[model samples]
Target chain A: MRFGVVVFPGSNCDRDCYHVIKEVMEEPVEYIWHKEKSLSGFDALILPGGFSYGDYLRTGAIARFSPIMPAVMDFAQAGGLVLGICNGFQILLEAGLLPGAMLRNSSLKFICQPVFLKIQRNDTPFSNKFKSMQVVKIPIAHGEGNYYCDPRTLQEMKDNGQILFTYCSADGEETMEYNPNGSLANIAGIMNGKGNVLGMMPHPERYSEDILGGRDGFNIFASMINWLKGVG
Target chain B: MLKANIYVTLKNGVLDPQGEAVKKSLKILDFGQVNQVRIGKFIEVWLESRDQAAAIKELEEMSDKLLANPVIEDYRVEIVEVNQS
Candidate 1:
């Protein structure tokens, strides 16, 4: 499958995502410029992490108006696979592709650390390789990743199994002590109701290799490949 | 010419971590009368249109579309200046 990693003005992790797909996964990957309107040949799209547009006004606000966003919205609406990581996740929320908004961390400081995540559901395309309730360690780096949504929307996502990953203890116990950003309900990741788009604050690409301290994130990429193959 | 001063703030029920930090600092200084402190963004936009009504409508659209996030924020716009020139 062909993968396209989007490069917004301030995006710094596009190369990391591209490397993971090309070198680690041995898949064809290309960098999609933010100004490009066409997503013609890509099988899946990735919005990597970084402070896009200098994170001005808001983290992802300015990047949402990029020329490529309308195309992204159309692609997602058509049920194409799209994964957003960190700042990319912020953009997805700003674009209304995923529900909720991101706010400053409760501590009011940038946090960069590995945190345990409890897989809430494995049926979705993003987590299909993980066992139910499995605990995986992945690093989160951001200043404003506190996710929030209305109670009604939260309930609906819960009902639909749209809530994918939640911050948890190494033992897979959900609690505030492990939540680095004080995200709503300790949510680390969520998927759209249609299950095509996923936005998560963790940097899976950063941990896709064992030399980077962990390979727990490799399965996320593998799951996508598996899902795509199944669909095809 | 018209200048619109817009204030964008978190909606009710959303926690303001930055404001909370400021409140803590204020408490350390012992002002004590402060019950709450919420921080928000103030944006000034200059419009070339002299028609106040039309300018206000355009400002509202700008706020709704880009200046403010309607999901978690509320924005108020005021025409602070109407240049006769």
Candidate 2:
């Protein structure tokens, strides 16, 4: 499947995502500038992490008004696969493609380290490669990755099985210490009600190779590609 | 010219680690009377409008759509009619 990585002016991880998907994964991938309005010919889109414009009001606050966002919203509404990582996740929250908002990390520091994530469920297109409750080591680097949502919305997401990943211990046990950002309910990632969009704070592209310290994170891409091959 | 000043802040129940850190530093500096500290953003938008009622409605919509995220933030808009000198 063709993949498009949206690149905002301040986006730093767009190259990382492009490298992994194009060179490492050997998939057709292209970078879509934030001002360009077309998303056609791409089966999936990845909003890689970074500080978009106006990191002032909030992480994704100003980036939502970029010229290309409306097209991205339309793509998502049409049931297209969209993966948002780190700051990308924040953009999705601001765009209303996902629930919740990001707050400063509970420690109030920029954390950059590997954290274990548990696949809460594998029913969606994103995590179908991993077993239920499977653990994967991914790196998270952000200061405002703390996820918060109203109680009612949280409950509704729970009921709809929209939560895709949660911070967990190395042994795959759900614990507080492993929650690097103090995210609500230890959530690390979530899908929209339709399950076509995913927003996760951790950077799977950062650890997509065993040579890079781990390969567990590569399964997410594998799963996405496999799902596309099957559905197409 | 009519200007709208908007303030967006985290909801009361949401955690504000950045604000909390500032509070801790203030305590270390021996600022005793301050019980708590919360941080928020203040923005000003200047637009062409003479009608206060219509301006207020438009500014509120602007804040809701772009200036603030409703899920975790509360925003207030104050309109000021600035006289052209």
In the predicted model 1, the residue pairs found to clash are none
lDDT tens digits by residue: candidate 1, B5-84:
99999999999999999999999999899879999999999988898889889999999888898889999989998879
- The candidates' DockQ values read 0.84, 0.86
Kindly list the per-residue Cα lDDT of model 1 for residues A85-179, writing each as its tens digit: 99999999999999999999999999999999999888878888999899999999999999999999999999998999999999988999989
What does candidate 2 score on TM?
0.95
Candidate 1 — number of clashing residue pairs?
A: 0
The weakest ten consecutive residues by lDDT in model 2 chain A span A223-232
Clashing pairs in 2: none
Instruction: Tell the DockQ for candidate 1.
Output: 0.84
- Deviating ranges (above 4 Å) for candidate 1: none
Per-residue C-alpha lDDT of model 2 across residues B1-85, encoded as one tens digit per residue: 7888888988889888878889999999999777888998899888787777898899899888888888878999888657674
